[model samples]
Target: MENSSPLVLMLLGAALMLCLHPLQAQIDGTGLFHDYYAKSCPKAEEIIKSIVEKAVKKEARMAASLLRMHFHDCFVKGCDASILLDDTSNFTGEKTANPNRNSVRGFDVVDNIKAALEKACPGVVSCADIVTVAARDSVVLSGGPSWIVPLGRRDSRGASLQGANQNIPAPNSTHQTLETKFKLKGLDVVDLVVLSGGHTIGLSRCTSFKQRLYNLTGNGKPDPTVDQGYLKQLTTLCPQTGTDDNQTTPLDLVSPTKFDTHYFKNLESGKGLLITDEILYSTKGSKTAALVKFYASHSQAFFQQFAKSMIKMGNITPLIKPSGEIRKNCRKMN
Candidate 1:
């Protein structure tokens, strides 16, 4: 009986391992986890959150900028921090990409977070992970839904200026173009609608959407879909010919600082600041239109899906162990 007891215990242990394998595989498939830095740098998330909170407190708009960094980085090279690389004599980076030039602020805030992390656990956390975590913290600070951001992403040694320009959807992109771009990244239309909710707290420059105010379709008239009152307001903010091209407007006029469904609501009212934004609801026969209406009314559903879509966006083609290095300085490869 004693000899048989050992075998019985061994069989039970094997069964347990088999049962847990799928769950473990699911978590490890992307080579990322909720507590990736728990052992190596226990205070990784704490340090990041604190720095982000400080920056956001100092400038509320910084929250949206930080979140935008993660999206821009992920879309170009799968959340590898390629967007952080500065231009060098021998190599050009993505900073000057059309989608990024004069836009995408918050580099200083990221530098602050990275500097603190290095002091706490030198060479432990990756810049890519810092951007990702800061994005989540940004959302939380902005009164948006929070989720466990899977960490362990590594920084790419190089940046792709071309990819940055091509992959990141332009503000004037058509609904089909936007849908195709997201789909190419393994995201669907729902992800498209939910992820666009990030605009809930950001601002857009006049140059991005001025065409709609002047000549949306080669005609010297504003986009007809634009609410006439909103169009008048936009023209005043962004004149037909002036230096206001660099001037800015909140993406969501209603509660621009808050991360909520106000962006979707704005779309319904034809007040969406960008053509890409309005097209989500205004595009004829677009599935995104229905989603816009649904999210506008159901704030909780929008919040939940926004969180999920963010996670999905963060999971894009990450570089794991033996793939990339942990960049010491986010702007330059280590």
Candidate 2:
């Protein structure tokens, strides 16, 4: 056993490296390229943009829904458009998952975009790629920073009901739980804080935050961490008990429709709507809290980091050519 110690240590280190390699690959953005569809579908992006713009113009919240759809799709089984699949006799879709259910909307918008793309290029653009581009466009359309979206991702044949429930962080998740979920997806503290900026534009339902306002610890008292004034407002918007579970309140009360740094500012002022959103700032002396403070003061830094993080999130194990097919319809496998 004298010399076996060194050999054992080396083997353990090698195994650790092997485990980390796949996570590194998830954020590498290697096979994706900026001009992937330049020749294959010269009008692919333009077609998606026109359709998304039209839909968002008609209803501004559609922009946030599309952005969230891409996030939901990427977190589960990679950015393969698996969230778009509907439930069939043989398959159970992610739409009814715990985190999604009534929360994730904008499938109709995705369907409309898919229809126009099939006509313009005919199987040249993948549904996965279309949603990814639409998400970026949504950010820009909502007055957020812009970045060159990488293309060439294909669709997943199967949607992951379990993956959708587990991978995506919940509004009530603890600080550590939120960190772990992001880490599982190859994200860091910065990514958690920045990508959470997506909440800057979206709405959360009453059921999602009732625990905080009504019975935080089963003591029939609201969460003390939440600002009292803001808590009062939320109480009015979300009753302690009602069938208004579907009622929505903006995640960011300030500049709710605009994708900006106000989300961080809200957390700083204790106006964040979701427990998960406010936890980034309220966790006390953590890196997540520090990043929240930084973003609150420096909007430019938040935008730059946000663009980089979005690209990283988009690179999550995409199904490139020959692995996943380009679905003729985004809602059903073909």
Candidate 3:
């Protein structure tokens, strides 16, 4: 009986480990695992989380910016930190891409995280993994669901200026265009609706959606789908002319700094801040409209699906060891 009890305990321990680190089994196939740095850099995720928390504390909007960085990076070149590269004399980077130019902020925070990680672990952690982990931490700090990020991604040697401009869905993207863009990345409609929830904690510049408030569809009238009061509010914040295009407003007026279902709720009431945002609920016979309604009514469901979708997005064509190098500096190839 004593021997049997010991064997039983051993089996239970194995089961517990499997449950705790399910992605560990994929380290061989996908070259990613929940504990990819368990031996190489035990404090990789901890270091990232701490830096992200400090950045978000200083500026709540930074949480969304960091999260957006991950999305933009992954969409451009499979989340290998290609978006982090800066243009040099001989090369152009994605920073100047139409979708990214002056829009994607938080590079300084990423550089800070990278500097700290490089100091602690040297070349053990890659900037790609740091960006991915920082993104998850940003969401958690903003009151969103937490998920285990599969790590071990390496950095790309080059940035894709063309891919950055073409791949990312714009604020004026149609529902079909958005879905097609996501599909190209192996994401489906569910991923689209849930991932769009990321706007819940961020702000959008006036230029991104100003047309919705004035001259949508080239007409001198605002988008009829926007609620009358919301249209008035947006117009005041984003005037037709002589307004700074860089002026920003909360993407989710209900709870802009906190990650929640308010984005979905706002969509239901026609207060969605972006044309792309409103399209999810306002487009005629949109498959996304049902999803927006479902998520609006089920906050927990939105949170859970969001975590799953993020994990899926993080897995897009990662460059594992031997395929790419670990970049010491995120801004330029090392």
Candidates in order, TM-scores: namely: 0.93, 0.91, 0.94
lDDT per residue as tens, model 3, 1-334: 4557887989988998877663555644566888789888999899999999999999999999999999999998798999999999999999999889999999999899999999999998999998899899999999999999988899999989999989999889988899999999999999999999999999888999998888889878889999999888888888889968898889999999999999999999999999999999997787899999999989999999999999999989999869889999999998
lDDT of 1 by residue, 1-334 (tens): 4567888989988999777754574466687877678789999999999999999999999999999999999999799999999998998999999999999899998888889999999998999999999999999999999999988888898999999999999988988899999999999999999999999998999999999999999968889888999999999999998575999999999998999999999999899999999999998887999999999999999989999999999999999888999988999998
Model 3 ranges with Cα > 4 A deviation: 1-24, 27-29
Deviation from native of the Cα of residue 309 in model 2, angstroms: 0.3
lDDT by residue (tens digit), candidate 2, 242-315: 56888888989998889998999999988988888888999988999999989999999999999999999999
User: On a 0 to 1 TM-score scale, where does candidate 3 land against the true structure?
Assistant: 0.94
- TM-score-sorted candidate list, best first: 3, 1, 2
Better model by lDDT: candidate 1 vs candidate 3:
1
Clash pairs of candidate 2? Answer: none
Worst 10 residues of 2 by lDDT: 21-30
Q: Which residue pairs show collisions in model 1?
A: 74-79
